[model samples]
Target: MAKKKSDGVNKSQAIRDYYAANPKAKPMEVAEAMKAQGINVTAQFVSTVKSNSKKSKTTRGRASAKKSVAKKPAKRATRASKATSEVSLDSLLNAKKLVEEMGGVEGARNALSVLEQLMD
Candidate 1:
């Protein structure tokens, strides 16, 4: 169906204006008031506008910040778990063999200290 032309007045805006004037007004009351002013709006539409306005006011930037902060911790945990899982048994065995070839863990540490000095 073709859209009906607006009578130059927005129904949702009318509902919001009425709600702004009467913050404690019920949806049915707002609907009745709008009907008296020749704006055809339902109580459900008024309720939806009121709720959406409240949600917009409450969640402006805080909600997005909260979501980003929450996601970072979960991503960090995923990265930590991935790092631990990537250390395979074969890699561990190779590391052990290297330590033994260096004579032991203490000897490996000493050798690493010497290698670090050489790299510098």
Candidate 2:
């Protein structure tokens, strides 16, 4: 098993070295290149690191210009909604009974929790 390398390489170096010998290449392509050269890296990791660096700059560019934005408050569910959400005792009992029939105690407990949350 290979020990993981340091994540200390800045995005500039990573991205530059990645596409230096393989320009116009994608992140997955870069990851494969890293693997070929024996650098422990994943495609997702490459994409994430590259995007993370760009994200700050991208956010800054948008910050200078105003955009229509509103934070919508979460609404409390109505009594009717709550009534409909009530967990049926019969359903829970049936789930428990089925789990017991299948010799699945753990499954019964999991199902019971779902039922309990609904009941609350």
What would the TM-score be for candidate 2 when compared with the true structure?
0.34
lDDT of each: 0.76, 0.64
Off by over 4 Å in 1: 1-4, 57-63, 70-120
Model 2, position 45, has a per-residue lDDT of: 82
- Compared with the true structure, what per-residue lDDT tens digits does model 2 show for residues 1-120? 997656665544666666666667888888887777666677788877676655656357425322344534434333334547675665566555567544587876787789899999
> Any residue pairs clashing in model 1, and if so which?
none
TM-score, per-candidate, Cα-based: 0.49, 0.34
Once superposed on the true structure, which residue ranges of model 2 sit more than 4 Å away at CA?
A: 1-12, 20-23, 57-120
Give per-residue lDDT, candidate 1, residue 14.
Answer: 87
Candidate 2 has its poorest 10 consecutive residues by lDDT at 62-71
lDDT, candidate 2, at 10: 54
